[model samples]
Target: MPVKIYHDEDTDITIVQSKVVSFIGYGNQGRAQALNLRDSGVNNIVIGNIDDDYAKQAREDGFSPVSIEEAARQGDILMLLIPDEDQQTVWNEKIRGNIKPNSTLVVASGYNVAFNLLTIPDDMDVVMVAPRMIGAGVRDRYVQHIPYPCFVSVEKDPSGTALATCLSIASAIGATRGNGAVGSSCREEAGIDLFAEQALWPEIMAIFREGFNVLREAGFSEEAILFDMYLSKEPAEIFERAADEGFVKQLKYHSRTSQYGQLSTMNRHDGKDIREKFHHILHDNILSGKFAEKWSNTKWAAEELAKEWKEVENAPIVQADERVRDVIKPDRKK
Candidate 1:
């Protein structure tokens, strides 16, 4: 289905400005978005954070940050901007009970909602304004007058105005600046995001690692191969160009020979294994909620993360990376 896409003109900033928007968690996305909204004339915005470095940063940023429960009590619209894993706990303890019965709950990630981890009051509305950009990028683009993309969704609309309010928040936070805000669902948002981490990024990372191994086997210098692989920032430039231009059309920036080599070889390589791997991740893990279930297990998650980190630390690439990085970008344990 062709999804509904809302542009600059579709949003009314006044809708959000009229409501009290309390940001619960003054971290990356939280700080960026709250400042964006305040700058955009949403003066009634509130910052809710615990007594931490983030709260200190919030104070430095000019917000008189309050407790989560206090903010929840004050806000007509409460944005849950903390990390996904922490949301359920925070909601159960500080937000769900203290928040007004009809207050609208907002999130920048669909993880908790998509996995049914949050216990939202039925009397309240639930919406999402997920920016596709990093937190710093969100603020940078907003300040530079550039636009960025975001996903806006209304998961629950008790008052029937959840969507308008959601889009209002999106535009206020500069999400409607670029290609506009994509109207999507929580499931689609979470599924695709998790799939990229579980499937797409893993494949890309493995490709780089294996490519390094292949060149190493071919007797390439560790420093030279590492620089050529990524340290030269060539890949970053390629990706930036891919973002600015169409993925295939970005080939215009490359030599005709390079373009032909890439395009032709892309076709010659059958991606049966990759396709199957991605399908398995999407179907058996992401859509089935198996990944969420596993990750939600705190003990298992912590253990798995520790094991993965140890594996990565012991990987051959890490030593090569440290050696190359020390020479290229000098740093010390001191």
Candidate 2:
């Protein structure tokens, strides 16, 4: 589908700033949005969570800290910023009974609402404002005084002002500081986010793990490969070149045009395998126990992984890894 973004001029901020805002969680997006709103002069805001620490923190941040039911009852706009799995329980126990007929319900992610994990009441409006970045980036950029865009979707708006309400809330969270409004559907947002996460995250870890293992097994310095790969010495440089133009530009800059010169010719024969290989890796990993085992041990496993990662990160090969083109760029620029 064609992507459409809404600008500040297209949004109506007073539509939401006039209402009583309640954020249902105190996690990354939750805290970021809630605090940003409060800082933007949004009054009558409350933060609710099961955790005392979270509640206390929210209260410390100048928002009213209330029980979930109280927050839902008092709020004209309720933002569900909790995890997808916990949303149902929160709704059933805390929100369902307190939500007024015309109140608005908001979600940052579309998974629960899209997948039918949490069904809203018939009389209420449902909308989503999903920021494309991770929660940390959202929060950190906010701290750094930068802005990012948020994807918005109105699932159900009996009041006929759902779009306006969503935009108001987005503005409260400082989304207007950037490029602003983008149109999205619950299904589309959920599908694309899930697919992108699955494709980029686990596979990236797998590649890192295999590379580190290979270097270690080769009797080479683990720190070298780890630093080279993790530090992105080569990748960063290539990216800089690519950013200025394209991969070919990067290759030319590095005088490696001849090294990849034959790749274009080989594509006719090997290109067909890319899709098949991706499918095989995806399905095969699922069919095997490898995926599950990766997280099986939880605590101990994560520590071990981190330790290994740290070792690799401190490796010497990290400096000369061919995959890294501009490791110094990130290290020095940042």
Which candidate number maximizes TM-score? Answer: 1
Worst 10 residues of 1 by lDDT: 325-334
Question: What residue pairs are clashing in model 1?
Answer: 147-177
Q: Which regions of candidate 1 are displaced past 4 Å? A: 331-334
Candidate 1 structure lDDT = 0.89
The TM-scores of all predictions, comma-separated, are: 0.95, 0.75
Residue 82, candidate 2: Cα error in Å is 1.0
Task: Give the C-alpha lDDT of model 2.
Answer: 0.73
lDDT (10s digit) by residue, model 2, range 160-188? 98988988887767676667768888777
Top candidate by lDDT: 1
Residues 244-287 of candidate 1: C-alpha lDDT, one tens digit per residue: 88788888998999999999999898999889989998999889
